[model samples]
Target: MKDSFCVTVTGQSLIKNDVRQIQHKRFLEVLDFLRQGNVVFTNFESTILGRYGGWPTKGRYFDYSRPEMLDALQTMGFNALALANNHAFDLGPAGVLSTLGEVWSRGFLHAGIGTDATDAMKPGRQRHGGHDVSLFAMDAGPGPGNMYAEDRSNGRPPRPGVNQLKTVRKLGVTKESFRTLAMLAQELRTSSLELTNYAQPDDPTAVIGENELNFYGTVFKQGSAFRRHVEIDPENAGEHLAAMQRAAARGDFVLAYLHHHHWEPGWQEVPGWVQGFARACIDAGASVFVSHGAPVLQAVELYKDAPIFYGLGNFLFHVPAEETEWSAREVWRSLVAACRYNGSGQLESIDLLPIVIGGEEETAANRLVPLAATGEVARNILQGFAKRSSIFGTEIAISGASARVSLAAARKVG
Candidate 1:
């Protein structure tokens, strides 16, 4: 019995308020798109495991309501979550451990988390459409892990106070993340590791002679296990290639949930090492690759049989009334394309599914709730998604049935 199926994979922006509320609202939105054979999946986009992870003072630790939040997501039809995003570290090491326990408790599938790098980069497989496919996450750029709590209390660390920009959103990569990227860039810049043209070998002052502490270009010692920057090293990347190759031979299809290093700030939309990442994945036999961490929608081109969505816009966000550009609709302005792997074992269609966020009540807190199971309220949501989104871009206009964005009015993309 060789069966094949399709699942809609989406990225989440942020979980601002009570974890439970955001989870509830998100669930409703997903239910609106559920089909008998289709599954809805997204990033949890938060850290609401327990109290030990919350930050002191301004650092809210960006927790959503717990147990209830997971229930709401399950109720809303979201089956899986990718924990590879930047916020996974919101509560620090304990936060991550807590989240791991939370996801397991709720019976949700998650990837991109662990006690260390090896665990975080490990892949998991799911049975769908009568076949099994593996999914994985890799931090391919520079970004900070969750901010550390400044002080400890009740066996919990104090949260790093919210810096509007840091607290509002995560673009998935940081300087540490990028240092991992720099090494990979070396792979592309120099086909052979011996290319000394860019990096001189003999000159005492040639390459700055900086000690290779680790991938992040920091200092490293013989016994040190973890460093500031970490990524899919040559050995790990090689292993992933091998695993992907095997999956292609046995499974019906292959997908890579790759988060690469950013060349620019998060607000601006563009391909961030996308051409390189997608082509590499396809060469390794992947059927589709979803690139995230951009503020707006990017182009989707079919490379071989696999399709690449440069960067899907925000499906959810916390309203940082302070930062105009990071709002939901602002990221939702351009139409986002979904790659559907129809009943056939091949890529089938790419259609625009306008992302819907900002759940019921219209209050900042509702942004934390999951959508209703009925999701009938979503139609009303799409009607205003564009206009509210414009608050980040510019003054938006919603007329007739849909939102119409103006040139000078849209949020500024830096």
Candidate 2:
């Protein structure tokens, strides 16, 4: 292993265009910055199309990329990819196999989707710059159950799909509201047996402590106020953490990545459970933790000498012309994080380079390319980032068009 190493992490890439054709100066500069890291990581948000042949699965929007799209990502110097996002199953099992085949052919270190549950849960390991790097990736979804990978059992064949970190949504309601729901269930003659049969295999309808009820498939808990909670399944979480521990025990640099769509009501707010989970991963021996789902930057934390990025937003978000939701500035603003570790595998510092997708002049031709942010735009982005990081007691120092997290200072206060 090398005495020191650097790893670069960026937001999800939902690219569909041949961005390598772009030669904008700022965009090229971003590419150069990414190449500086021994391992450049990004989530490949779109599944490959046509090569292996498949039909579109149901989704609010279907994202399919051509084979050459991988070339564009490689051109940007991304050698590590997470393939377990919601869109991984957009074209069914064949699409998963196609994507896996294409990514493998390109010699990229990738994880997440696989031919079965065991395969999906396994980490992707590679040796880069004299460092053994291991990546464990999964998706926490409020998505269709069938989209997740399943192992073969009872004479059935295994399913090819994304690695899943199962989570359940619990609705917290007032005592009165719970009573009303129970009464309505009785009035409608809702059958518990039928509800259980229709529920996902891992989530069954049940009652708890006389104050909680699983009506239909939703679990409602009696509480002081109405709220929503996302609970990670311990068994699923344990499996992923165990994988990280095993990798770290082997003296590998472990990277844990999670993709989820369970955003807080305030899109930019980091969920408490996610914070707990990321910390748990570090405790389990992850060298770094990163998550993406909310299409906006959230927060960054330096915990126990490891960096945790709650959300990294979008890097290359290409959507249909009709998709105007992405036009919002927040969706286009993000930063590329370069983390440097010392000889003993302790974090030394982090350089945050603020970037804006499509640059100042966003047009059809350059809409999905990311460019370096400068002047007022850069300061504003870094300021907002600093404010968000402050929530976790992470102090970021802004300088010129970029920001940095120094390990010595972070340790002094952490």
Candidate 3:
């Protein structure tokens, strides 16, 4: 076995064009940095609109990328990709097939989307650095029911879509507030039966619980205090966890990736449920756990010698010029983490390089390119990242333009 295996992880990539022609000095430096990893990984966040043929599923703000974008990512030195995200189905089922075709044709180690639920849940495996590496990707979604892959049964055909880690959102309210809402529902005659009649077959109305009321599809429960809760479906989580265990039993290094839109009141705040789930992944033998959905850097935690990156923000956020909604500077700032593991498959250290998409220019021409952050910008990025990681009891040592997680200290405490 090789003395060490290095895996580089980055934030989601939403590229819509071929960017191989750009020769920006800083962009090239970022590319050079990416090439150092034995297995460079990223979440390919767009659906391909090519040979398989697809139509825009959304009325507006939907995205599709040309096949050449994969080539651009390959040129950027990404060998492994996670193909599960909110935008994975922008062009519908055909888009899923299109993305699978293009990615597979390039022989990239990719996972997360497939022709059926069973296929989608399978891990993507490869051999790198004389070690077997497995990656499993999933999306915890509040998306349409048809956006998730379904197994064929009876005489029906299987649906092609992304792997889904199903989650339920429950609005918890005080008993008094719950009674008021229940009365409103009763007065409006929006009972479960009434809503069921209007609901689509694929997305049925939620069943009312003994202490809960189903307002349309949202479930509200009486509780001690008013709060919003997102719970992972046990069945879905079990399936993914079993797969990770199987991969680990085979002695393959496992990387678990999750994409979700369940943001807390503060975008950068890490949800408690997510923190628990990430720890569960580490327990299930994941060498690293990464997630992206909220477009801002979140906390980093080291658990049982594994690194959990709650959010890495965005690496290549290529939205339409008119999409001013993503104008925030934090959306363009991110980190490139290189996790090194010894030959024994134990994580040794992690090097974090702060980067800013489009550098300091923030112009249309430099939009899709990532540049190494420098000077005060680099310090500010590291400072903010250190503060977030500190919340998890993880120490980040910043030196000059880069930072590193203190794995020795983390391991000692673990």
Which model scores highest in lDDT? 2
Q: Per-residue lDDT of 337-377 in model 2, one digit per residue for the tens?
A: 99998777878889999999988665655677999999998
Which of 1 and 2 is ahead in TM-score? 2
Which window of ten consecutive residues has the lowest lDDT sum in model 3? Answer: 190-199
Give the Cα-based TM-score of candidate 3 against the true structure.
0.96
C-alpha positional error of residue 146 in candidate 3 after TM-score superposition, expressed in Å: 0.4
TM-score of 1: 0.60
Worst 10 residues of 1 by lDDT: 161-170
lDDT of each: 0.50, 0.90, 0.89
lDDT of 1 by residue, 245-307 (tens): 777877536666655445344344344345665677778888777766665555454556555
Choose 2 or 3, whichever is better by lDDT: 2
Query: How badly does each model clash, as a count of residue pairs?
Result: 44, 0, 0
The Cα error of candidate 2 at residue 343, in Å, is 2.6
lDDT for predicted candidate 1 compared with the true structure: 0.50
Better of 1 and 2 by lDDT: 2
What lDDT tens digits, residue by residue, belong to model 3 across residues 1-414?
A: 566889999989999878899898888888887888999999998999988898887766699899999999999999999999989999999999999999999989999999999999999999988888899999998778888999999998999999999888889999999999888878767444465654555565354566788876778889999898888888889889988999999898899999999999888899998998899898999999999999888879999999999999999989888887888888888889999889888888899998999897666667778899999988988899999898898999999989999987887787
For model 1, what is the alpha-carbon lDDT of residue 284? 85
